[model samples]
Target: MQRIDSVNVRPDVNGAGKPGFHDNADLSGQDATYLTPTWLNTVQEEICNLIEKNGYTLNVASRQQLYDIIATNDSVTALAEAMENRLVQLQAVLATKSALEQGISYVMSELGQHKTASNPHPQYLLASTFGVHIPMTAAIGRTEIKDENRVLGWNGQSSDWTANTGEITWGGSLSGSVEFTPYRAYGQFLLSGYISTATFFDVNVRVFNAEGIETSLIKVTEYGGSYASYGMNKVFEIPKGGKAVIEYRVDAGYSKRAQMTFSVYVDDRVKVFTPVGLTSVVDATDFTESTQNDVKSDYSSFPAFEWFYGDTNGQYFELSAISNMSDPVNKIPHYHRDKFTQLEKDLYIAVQAGKQTIESPSDYAVIDTQILRARTDAEGNVVVAVPLSMRSITTANNETLVYTFVYYLNEPDVTGALPVGLDGEHKIYVRL
Candidate 1:
């Protein structure tokens, strides 16, 4: 597969001035020199026919052709409108195909060990591997400054801190704590919940380990003189053989009710190796045939751009003017051209981020003409970073050129056969 750098059609305009498209003809005219209504209808019908012939699917090349038409004749009101609508529908199909391909690639890359004939669905295996959900009780256990009127529960109701018949004269503070045990070993743990408060007070929430050591999870100190609500999603590592303790505090001088509901989800203990021990380690010197084949196949299938639209061919009928569109001399001012250019870069980044990664420091390969670097951290987490220079696009810009490029890649088979050795000598544990 080949990678694309810039889809800029104009060579004369340098830097940010290039509109990335060419003006073939005055689309505002109805003459034969411009795109006629008859030509536009014919092209639309032909594209529709091609899509129907291909089982209502447009290949990467066909989609690019349509995008070329849309880009070149976008100034033609009626023709551009029709093609734009069709392009949107086609893009939807392409997006779905892209998602399916990415999903299959992920299963093939990440859960290759779990692929089996007996359980052909890798997703189910993946779910069983890391879908352990041990629901913790969200009830508030104890409080520091307790009051009889203060209420706390996990029944989706407001936990109130009210004065005892105007005893404190709208000034008081309350705190509570809860403790729960984790179900598994070390993994990513997510704590998500929301808190609603009234009478304009400050709320602080924290999580502590089994040793009474506080882990700073959530803290809100700013107070507005009205009701306020907050939502939190915090991810933390759960140490081996340890539990979590949740603590919350509310301070206010007026009548305030703070309602909070939270839950914890711990990642399941799914190991890359069956028996996670020293014996499970393989000798670095020994390379099997299957291992060599796997490495070769991965290198052979590295994702790349299969096709790209550099110019408008099918949409612009006048061959001479259309050919001259890429010339550096004939330049047209397009205000939104930079915005479209940025969008192209963004799309490339998104695709590369989803699919590509650096294996080592020396492997400096470019994808879609941009260099991406990946490094493993101290905790063995791969962090992929792409260098970006920000350029702002605003509606205030008057001269802008818009060019469209449609990228299409072959979708992988979602219902394909699973890999061998999926049902190896390991017990499949399902979460209840």
Candidate 2:
């Protein structure tokens, strides 16, 4: 785009009485004397020509750019300063973008017939209208209030649901089986067995689905004749009307008496769980109504997910989309400092990709676990020019924290930024 124009050779006139003006008498015969004034001038012109040809020649339109680079342009117009200015501009743009994105962090990703399963709970989610529970909703701290909470299941009383087999005589590697069915949604199951006159017999245990399919199997090395029974927890998700069958068999042909039992129970926990699709119903379109709504109140079909049961209902719409410690993807973005989205006023989920979607409260899990999972999304064929996501969060509440400080009583009264006073007492520090 730019180039320098070349100038031909040229030199100033020579001095009047310069040396070698003539073949001097003393140095007359030197190799090429006096190269006279004309000759000297000619050679000087040739050197000047070479210099002109060697130099860069440009026909630049903006010669002022060259002037600024070659001459210090007040230090402010240099390339480094220009770069710094551009960086400042870029940072300003990025800061604005981050503020805006975070402002709407818990908001729905998209609109249209969207559906989510928080706030009102899936049981109370209206069928015709899409509903979701999102950050800062009314249900933010009420996850433990549902009837399905494990703490609610135990009243310091014996479990209302447990099945067992009494001692029975059997021989020739005989097996015993026990089955238990639930009338309502329940979780927290355990397995244990006893044997009479075991005499160190090898045993095999198994679990089966309703279709009599063996879903899991395990072997035990020995069972003693002692009265102590072996116990194990976290059986599996067992839905209502669905029966779980467990069977135990001994390897020896010795005649022995044996029994097995399984129970649904829970222990004391710092956290609680809730049932889905089961929220308080109100008549007004706004869920804050005083009267009960005539629509979507039947919770008979809502699946109650127990805490420690892993994730949400598989055959259902799941996840609070509510901001919790592990699943903080949904929370009140801000109170006075933040703004809430209108998935209908800080409500439920908006599946990023699909709109016409259906989620039922997960009935049961196919895995053995006790911890409720974080808000999870199904993996899919999602590819984008710029991939992004968000997860809400706060401090975990599983336990409490305490701090301590120590000081010696005999040190000198040290002053001004010392670790301890001269009296040996340590100084307390408050961080800014």
Q: What count of clashes does model 2 give? A: 33
Question: At residue 61, what lDDT does model 2 achieve?
Answer: 59
Q: Pick the candidate with the highest TM-score.
A: 1
lDDT of 2: 0.29
lDDT of 1 by residue, 1-432 (tens): 111123323444345643333452444532222334555677676776554433245456564644444455543576668799899867765778786687577657656655545535433343344443223222222211232212212111222221111111112233455544433333344555555553333334454443445665655343543446666555555444444545544432222324444444323222222221111111112112222111100111111211111223322111111211122112221110001211111111111101112223323222232221121122222211121210122223222212211211222222322112211111111111
Query: In model 2, which range of ten residues has the least summed lDDT?
Result: 381-390
Model 2: how far is 411 from its true place, Å?
83
Candidate 1, superposed: residue stretches over 4 Å from native: 1-174, 200-224, 250-258, 266-432
lDDT of 2 at 310: 19
In candidate 1, how many Å is residue 258 off?
4.2
- Residue ranges of candidate 2 with Cα displaced over 4 Å: 1-164, 169-174, 184-188, 200-214, 218-243, 250-264, 267-432
Instruction: Tell me the TM-score of each prediction against the true structure.
Output: 0.22, 0.20
Q: How much lDDT does each candidate structure score? A: 0.32, 0.29
